[model samples]
Target: MTSPSDGTLVAEPRTDAWEFGDFAYGLEPLTMPPVGDATVSSALVPSALPPCNPDLVLFRLRLLAEGGTPDLPDTFTDPTDDQLFWFRWITGHQISFLIWHLMGEILERNTDREIPDRASLARLETYAYGYCAMLLYTGSCPIDLYQSLIRPRMYLQHRSFSGTWASDFVPVRGLFRGRGVARGDAPEAAGLARAVDVHKTIHDGIAARLVPEGRSLLQQTMKETVVRPSERTAILYDNFFMTLRAPVDGEGITSQLLRRLDAVASDVAARGLYPLGYGGDERPKELRSAEVAHCENRIGHLLHEVGEAAATPAKPLS
Candidate 1:
């Protein structure tokens, strides 16, 4: 008769091996019959089992991604303190500036007049700034529940934003029409897009390999706690692109501009995850770091491209 332990699936196994789905019946351990014909009793036991609650990992990620406050920390009473200042800065000022800049750039190119009305520019800037601030405040949170919560939601959000940005850029080619500026002229956009493509490449490449490696590290460092370094990096990368593509105008802002601003705010949100003082203040030494310097150069190049694109003339939409 089948009993618990030998081949039985009862009494609950370790958390890692527990399968949330079907529970196998307990079977007695016994020697198999000859190879001529193996009976049901002779079936081989599974060498390994899937995790019990995969959702738990995703849920933890969400908590960490959305855990902090913009104006005040839930646990801290000080309102003016910057202890969580990075969080607030990302959600508030940075994003707004990004959106306003993008809007101004787009509007300046599309509008016929050489000089746009000051009032309109002011209004656009205000709206873009306000929305960025709001987004920063709302999106900035702690990393307490990242493994189970934040990662899954962020994955979905990242996909949605990526799709939206691609779709939006299709029609805007008209804004860059004329002025002999070939699509190739915006090499920086192409480069940024390439960087994003590489980021995704690394993400997919390391999904199984790096994710578990990172999780193992976290488990070692903080028992019972699973950290999602890959997911965090992905979200931050998304923010960086959004900011990098922020719209700009010589005049006022527009809705298109706000969208770009949101990108910067998102970048700030992503960067906030890193410890504030982790990078030392040695400019030359710091610049030598490939990853850090690459990002700085990329941002600078992208900004220059956008600025140049804005300065080019556009045929009015008939």
Candidate 2:
């Protein structure tokens, strides 16, 4: 097994890796797409989207069925450190593909069906945290690269492509705003509420660091009209993450989520989250530490908590 000590992450299979099919009822991959590939980025085009968000859990299942390999950049085994830097950012977005849709499922069930037990909600929280962790990795890209390449590509999608306009997430905005069924007799609800707030906070911090000018996305885009949440915006969000839309079973969603989660955990463990190192001086003081060691430590900690929450929710998080 290739330990993380040397930081040469060729990626070996983990012995303790979990098979989500055995316990598919619960929980998330790590890879990047080919650079400058117009074909894979079709989610940004209005003509490419479905009338509504496709069941993302199904999309994941389809990927697994096709040999469990998601899209990849031209080079995987070896790339210059500079190229790997951007690869991490792209991989971060790729992993986030599942996190966004899974949260929507949790919110829908809370409002429409029997309230979920704490364990289930807690497991859901791990996915939410995984989303936050993805945001962190995205910001790991240097500001110069982000502005020169990443920001411009996003502009091609929409002038004001804000997170608030994700169609599936629009109905649940109150939860992040502290107006949802967070408290009352449901402690799990409150925990989820907290996770949402944290996710937003981290998002804001990342934006500030990456775009220190403090310009709103709208301001940056130089557009005044706020795009409403609809199929358009939903597709735009998925396009940014390069998620594919496909139909799959509702019950299969849980199994697929768990499968995706294990793949990501195994991949990151084998190759530390920010293998090149935390973008030094670019990272925020509150989160950056030990140069590179801090982020590697954090990656292990966050994923471990998420895995524990999904695999053994009966136990308390450490």
Candidate with the greatest lDDT versus the true structure: 2
Candidate 1 regions exceeding 4 Å error are 1-149, 152-255, 258-293, 296-304, 307-318
Q: Candidate 1: what lDDT? A: 0.32
Q: After superposition, how far is residue 188 of candidate 1 from its true place, in Å?
A: 13
| Per-model TM-score on C-alpha atoms | 0.25, 0.59
Measure candidate 2: CA RMSD: 12.4
For model 1, how does the per-residue alpha-carbon lDDT over 113-142 read when each residue is reduced to its tens digit? 433344333333233223323332322333
What local distance difference test score does each model get?
Answer: 0.32, 0.50
**Candidate 2, after superposition: displacement of residue 301 in Å?**
4.9
**Candidate 2: what lDDT?**
0.50
